[model samples]
Target: ARDGILVVRPDSGELPKIVLDVLESLAGKFGTSNTPTGHKLLPPKIRVIQGDGIDINSLEMILKTMTAAGWAADNLAFGSGGALLQKLHRDTQKCAFKCSYAVVNGEGVDVVKDPITDPGKKSKKGRLSLEKNADGTWSTITEGKGDPAKDQLVRIFLNGDLTVDEKFQTIRDRSNVGL
Candidate 1:
């Protein structure tokens, strides 16, 4: 689940008892601490690994074991989302984006995707909203418009898992500079 991936094969590696110990410890602190949470334990998406490229055969074995334990081996449900996120970090640079805002009386929350105009001009501790246009193009909200002064938020649905560089890019913060 960390490095390359543990495929849904019948021969995933032994899973190493150490990994199990870590999972168990994590389970005790979060959620029900059940096997499911253990299985989903991730080392803070920012963590890094060595040269442990995943092997198809080894992944198969792990999947088999997970299945025997009554847990679905589906990628989306189990480790797929995180794996996909990791791949994105390894491949490109993007982060999930979210912006929240509130509208004043007689006005609506101004949502904007254009960093320079909306988020850039405003403070850096909130969310942004994306408005759906008739033509489908996104517009950065400046002044309160549209809805009647309601709070709205927006965030990019990044892949989730991200590499160091990808994480930096995904943030899309002021440090990046120049929008």
Candidate 2:
């Protein structure tokens, strides 16, 4: 037991209440010390992991309850597995990819999907290109008016051939430019 901390995971029961109860029980058995914030900290040998039914809302509630009960946030950790991804669907963010523009017979054709039943589902029309403005912000140019030379969207594939093959780390670094 001295080699590592023992993580006690409570998988069932009401999260906020159960977490507080477990902390209280652990404090009674293994004891605790007070933090600078006047919150109780579990001994170095033990901690609690609350993994079930965990979502943003429940996590916030549990933290608030623990803080109110004089327990430090360090006494507990969280695991968000199914609650992190299982509850999500495409409609959650209103995300979809449709053919906005296509070229056939050497002519540009604009394709749009705007269902009268759901105006929010309206899609963009005409050829689209991403442009970085002078303010360092990005905007999509529509109706095929964007200058192809300045477009940030690189053609990665063309006619069964790979055009631009970029390393994953390069793309990740580019995505983190402003942040």
Candidate 3:
């Protein structure tokens, strides 16, 4: 029990689970998973533990991962909300929304609202708030629901629904900042 930072067992085999736990707890912090085996790459994966009641940033990371993996992702407006999605990856490819957001949700993430601007005659009224679902579907939770996540999906589902994905994409493709 006394070898300083490097202690060796003097007798019998050791239970490895203790060692594994320590590593995983730390790994979970830096965009990785804490599997029983050890730290694992968790890119493009989603893990929501409502049981433990974790915060949104972590949940958002998982959602971001899912989107990057080309999977449908939705975060109920009441769900994961804090994000700073860069027009493009800070390290990898750059990304930017094609439209001028009345509100910037977080980095690449878009938390769109209905009635982008008052219809002139009014100040602000009758806006819709759309929520993204894990199934890659969207439903209005409020008056403004033009979330980036819904762009392509609504085209096929709602038919009459118009999305701003391309408009935002165009801005991203051109702007010095994918604003």
Evaluated with TM-score, which candidate comes out highest? 2
Q: List the residue pairs that clash in candidate 2.
A: none
Q: What is the lDDT of candidate 2?
A: 0.84
Off by over 4 Å in 1: 1-18, 33-53, 70-179
What would the per-residue lDDT of candidate 3 be over residues 79-176, giving only the tens digit for each residue?
22123343233213322222322333543333432322223212222334456567755464433446655533233223357454566667577655
Q: How are the candidates ranked when ordered by TM-score, highest leading?
A: 2, 1, 3
- Candidate 1, lDDT over the whole model: 0.38
RMSD of 1: 16.8
> Which candidate number maximizes lDDT?
2
TM per model?
0.23, 0.48, 0.15
Q: Once superposed on the true structure, which residue ranges of model 3 sit more than 4 Å away at CA? A: 1-53, 75-179
Sort every candidate by lDDT, greatest first: 2, 1, 3
- TM-score between candidate 1 and the true structure: 0.23
RMSD of each: 16.8, 16.6, 20.8
Model 2, 13-110: lDDT tens per residue? 66698899889989999999999989999998899999877889999999999998889999999987666668764446867788897788988798
Candidate 2 global TM-score = 0.48
Worst 10 residues of 1 by lDDT: 44-53
